[model samples]
Target: MCVLGYCAGRYRCPNCGRSYKNKVNLGRHMRWECNKSPAYFCHACDYKTCRKDHLKVHLISNRHLKNVAGKIRYPCLHCGKSYTMKNNLRRHQRVECGKEKSLVCYVCDRRYYYKQELDTHVKLKHNISAKIEGFPVPMHWKF
Candidate 1:
């Protein structure tokens, strides 16, 4: 099968048969985003993924956030639901987490991750420069 446009060939992905132009990219894909046969294993738990970055994500999200209850408690800010991984929490918050964001943009009511993000949005979308409180002023203030 053809992946995107590349035909299945010697450089095709082993998991999905998505062909690539060279081995370096294939190696990178296998090490980071293969849908199957993930070699990197998380010893902190049974979590395994194809990419090494995922392993680190799992550690920071699942292991580091784990508490006295021995449960990964990265809760979705929108809902009370807890997650083992922060990425999962982020996904849930963005999609099906069933929660409302507190930081709503005054211009268009768009939600954001942080208050400063909302300020930036107001400035860009509304053409109103709402400076962040206690924000470090940029140098080159010519008076």
Candidate 2:
């Protein structure tokens, strides 16, 4: 096995069967010589990407954001809540309205409607450590 480091070492290209002294040189050779097809060519915007999944995700998220920004429709069934995007409405139903009952703590097996509620429950009830998106869980005491 080749040692993983930032040093020039003898390596072989898998695609072109070419020997290179460094990984960076091998990668450059592959990019310029071996892999010529652009996998992630965006049809609408004419954007080129090497990764197909990234381009797909970009297209999907761009369309979703555009649709969300355009119109406000679709009301929640339970609480009469309205949202501009169907995805947002689905997220709201799952998180805020307690429709799907999806949020559950892995450590304590506590069920919560929203992630915020779950964090509070974990902190207050079980005293177990939990974090959400790098934010520290807030302590809420019932008075």
Candidate 3:
């Protein structure tokens, strides 16, 4: 059989047959990720990942310890709500746990708990810039 110039899927895992672009990636996959039991797991839930950063992100994004009593590592000073992650606790204090919904969407008149949420809403739903213009609007604002 005549081989092609550059055979794609040439590098495949021996265990799972998952293809990679290069041998280095394939070797790394086999050594660390491929067919391996997830080394990182959430303490609050069954969520698991192969990487530490992924586990950190999962812990930060989800309210895993909200209802789990005694596991709260970070507690809110104002409302006494608990969180598994410190960053989550900080976010709860800043935007949630009785904070007012100050940032409003000018287009749809929708309310948001945080500035980031409002910014995302405006950018995605309205497809408009979330930046607040200065009192004297700049020339670049013409767009």
TM-score of each: 0.26, 0.26, 0.35
Q: Relative to the unseen true structure, what is the C-alpha lDDT of residue 100 in candidate 2, on a scale of 0 to 100?
A: 53
CA error at residue 91 for candidate 2, angstroms: 3.7
Q: Over the stretch 94-113, how does candidate 2's per-residue lDDT look in tens digits?
A: 65685556666666666666
Model 1, CA-based lDDT: 0.64
User: Where in model 3 is the C-alpha error above 4 Å?
Assistant: 1-81, 131-143
lDDT of 2: 0.63
Q: Name the 10 consecutive residues with the lowest summed lDDT in model 1.
A: 134-143
In terms of lDDT, the poorest run of 10 residues in model 3 is: 134-143
- Cα lDDT of all candidates, in order? 0.64, 0.63, 0.66
TM-score of 3: 0.35
* Candidate 2, position 64, lDDT: 36
lDDT of 2 at 78: 70
Question: Which of the numbered candidates is closest to the native, going by highest lDDT?
Answer: 3
Q: Candidate 1 on 26-88: residue-level lDDT in tens?
A: 788776677667778866567877777776667556454573338757865444577767788
After best superposition, candidate 1 residue 140: deviation in angstroms?
Answer: 34
